[model samples]
Each structure stands twice: as structure tokens, then as C-alpha cells.
Target: MEPVLLALKFLVPLAYLATTAIYGRLFFAPEESRFARKATLGLAISLILHIALLLCLGYSLQRCPLGTIGEGLLFLAWILAVIHLLSEWLADTRRLGLFTLLPTTLCVVVGVFLLRPDFALPPQLQSSFLVFHIVASLASYACFSMASILAGLYLVLHAKLKHKNFDITFRKLPPLDKLDKLSANWSFLGSATMVVASVIGWVWVRKDGLAGMNFKELAIYLVLAVFLGAGISRRLFGWRGRRHAIAILIGFLLMLLTNMIGTHGFQN
Candidate 1:
């Protein structure tokens, strides 16, 4: 098992790289429809290997794999890969693969290389409910990242159109409406997942009779508020077009800030 885990530590990143390359080729050469199937196969294979690697690492450590920043990043990479693959299967569009998988590959490479398994898992963090809460939070973050990426692309394409710059890059991107819809879908998913995470945290707090909130908890709640606002504005006020897209981008930024504060705290 040790040897297998060691091998997987390296194989997972390579698999992500190979999968990303497949997506790149598919995106640049849309004429060759053959690459579509190949891309999907590569993504699926990479995702499977990534999952196996994480599971093995967790088993060996006798703890969740998210004990450190690197491990948390690996988990995010896994979730991003999972979401992108599901999007491809459900939407039947490979247009977003290159954009999505490039960051995923980078995350895997950084995470795999930066892994610090020697770090001890805190005893207080071993509760199953806490693990679920953290998992849910990470899942929400991954979805928010996806939503932001989509929104950024939409903005870029929108700018190109406004400037009358119709290049191959513009043509390669999904249509504005498609990008808008995809971004909205991912944002909604992120919001819903964040709600779940918040609920889990609340339940854990009540179950343990915790008295006070930590900085990380405050940040999470603030991030949740941002997403909830975005959802409400879109639903009730009929906010659409660039306004909604920009709102999503802003929410993503807030999420990132929350992560940073959670990681570093405000002791200074």
C-alpha cells in the first residue's frame, strides 16, 4: 500500500496534465471531433486516478487528506475535475474543458509537490461532523471558482465583441448566452452548497454547545451572505447581463478573501 500510494502521488498530477493537454487539443482543433471523446476519456481517467490517490493518502495517514493547505488544494483540484467532467457529460459541450482543466492541472501539480503528510492532524479536528463541514465548504469553494472562471470568460468575450475583435480566441469561446447560463448554474450550485455547509456548521455548533464563533466561521458566514445576496438579486430583481456576471466575479473574490482570512486569521 505504501508503494502504491507513493506511485499515485506522482501519477495523479501527470494524469491531470495529460487530461488538460487533451482538452487543449480538442479546444484548438474543434474540426477534429475525435478529440472530444478522447478528452472526456482523459478527464474521466484523471479524475479516477485523483480520487484513488486521495483515498490512499487518507487511509495511510489515518485522517482526512485535508490536514494541510496542500492537501486542501488537492481536494479542490479533485472537486473541480469532478464538476467539469459532470458538466461535459450533462451539457454535452467540451468548450469549457481547456479553461477548467488548466487550473485543475496546476492545482494538482502544486498540491502533489507541496504535500506535507508529516503534519500531525489535530485531535479536535477529528470529528466526523467537522470533516463533513469542511468537505462541504471546499465543495462550495470549488463551485465558486468554476462560476468565476465562466463569468470572467464571459466578460472577456463581451469586451472583444464590444471592441469588434473577432479573433480565433473569440470564436473558441462559448457564446455569450451559453457562458452566462453556465456561470449562473455554477453560482447557484455554489450558493446551495454553501448553505449546506453553513447548516452543517450550525448543527455541529449546537451539538457541541459551542459558545463563540471563530474568525474562520465569521469569514464563512460573510462569504455565504455574498452568495445569498447574488442569488436573491438574480431571482427577485431579475438582474441579468453583465451586472449579474460581475456580481458573481465579486462574490468569488469575497470567497477568496474569506479563505485567506480563515487561513491566516486576524491576530495581527
Candidate 2:
């Protein structure tokens, strides 16, 4: 059942990528403006399909789709897609979607392909808190990744502007200040989520099965601390621009590493 679900997950992402790629090209094309509208419709269709597939998986498994590396990452990708779409509407930017959503879909597909299908849930993961923790952490990671991209864009823009040359791509971006504010806000929100999740996780660990200091526990703490500390600095000293972007990238990388090490090594 797990393997079949794992295989089925691939279809949704493939559908997603196909649609988004079409959107990206259509959005950039000069010949026709209809492409953007068409592409957006495609994205909408793909999203609905993805959500339905996930619901089916959850219903069949009678679990919160957190059972394995593949399921978790794919769901994370779904979340990122949702967030990306919402942010696009809120921020009023179509160009950014091409960068953030496409890679996420690809990565989710790859994660689903590589991860084990029958990965059993441990005794400790039986609680609702575990779901909260996992969901919060992944959502935060997605935002931070977005922030990092914003930062990278800032770098490229700043460089071109510094050289006294106008780059078309840079001009399309929201004002420098707007992008900076968005990145900071994303990280700040992500950090808050992580902190809340971590606190709940502590309670879950205390009550369920985890009492000793496990490597995974330590990793979670380290990630929580990194984001919290960064958030504090941003709030106090007005952290923004390149420095903020670098910090977001660094923090997300730590979170990813901890996830990889814990899920793979500990499972054996």
C-alpha cells in the first residue's frame, strides 16, 4: 500500500511540473498574453489534483501522511506550493512563482522516489504533536527557502545597479525595500512556527516515549535555536538585505541536514 501510494505521489508532482513549466514559458512569451492565463489554469488544475491525491492517501492509510521520508517531503512540497501561490496573490508577483514552485515540485518527486515506502511510525510519533512539529518545521523551511531566493535576487540586483547597468529582471522585482521586508517577515514567521512546534514537541516527547537526549532531539533544538536567534537579531538590529538572506539560507541548510541524518541513520 505504501509503495503504491509512493508511486502515485509522483503523478501529482509530474502534473504540477508540467503545468508550471508551461506557465513559466507562457508567462515570458512575447507573442501572446493568453499563455499566462492558460498556464495559471493549468496550475490550478494541477493543484486540485495534487490535493485530491493527498486526501486519498490520508484516507486510505488512516494516518497524517507523515509515515515516511517520501510522504513527508511530498506533503511539504504541497505546502510550499500552497504558500507560494498565496504569496504570489498577496505579493502580486508572477515571476517569482517560476523559481520557487518548480524546484519544489521536482525535489518532492525525487524525495518520493528515493524514500522507503513502508517506513513504520515509531512509538513516539503516535501523537498529534508529532504532526504539528513536522508540519511546522517543513513549512518554515519552505519560507526560509523563499527568503533565501529573495536574498539571492537582492544580490544580483544590487550588483547590476552598483555597476550602473539596468537589468530587466531586476527592474521587474518589487522595490528593494519591499523584497527585503518580505524576506524578513517570512523568516520571522517561520521562526515563530518552529518555536511553537518545538515547544509542543517537547511536551509530546515528555509524555509519549522520548525522555533521553537523542541525536534527533538535539538536532531539533539546534534548528530551533538558530532561527530564534536570527529572528531576535532581525527584530532588534533591523537585520535586512544580504545579511538576512545569508542567514536564512544557512538556517534552512541546517534544518535539511538534520532531517536527512536523523531519518536515514536512525531508521536503521
Q: Which ten residues in a row have the lowest lDDT in candidate 2?
A: 259-268
TM-scores for every predicted model: 0.91, 0.85
Each model's lDDT comes to 0.83, 0.70
Per-residue lDDT, model 1, residue 85, is 82
- Residue by residue across 90-146, what tens digits does model 2's lDDT show? 986566667776767776777657555346677556668768878877777777777
Q: Positional deviation of 53 in candidate 2, in angstroms? A: 1.6
Q: Pick the candidate with the highest lDDT.
A: 1
Question: Which residue ranges in model 2 land beyond 4 Å of their true spot?
Answer: 1-10, 26-32, 115-117, 264-268
Model 1, TM vs. native: 0.91
* Candidate 1 per-residue lDDT over residues 130-191, each given as its tens digit: 67877998899899899888898999999999999988768888788888888888888888
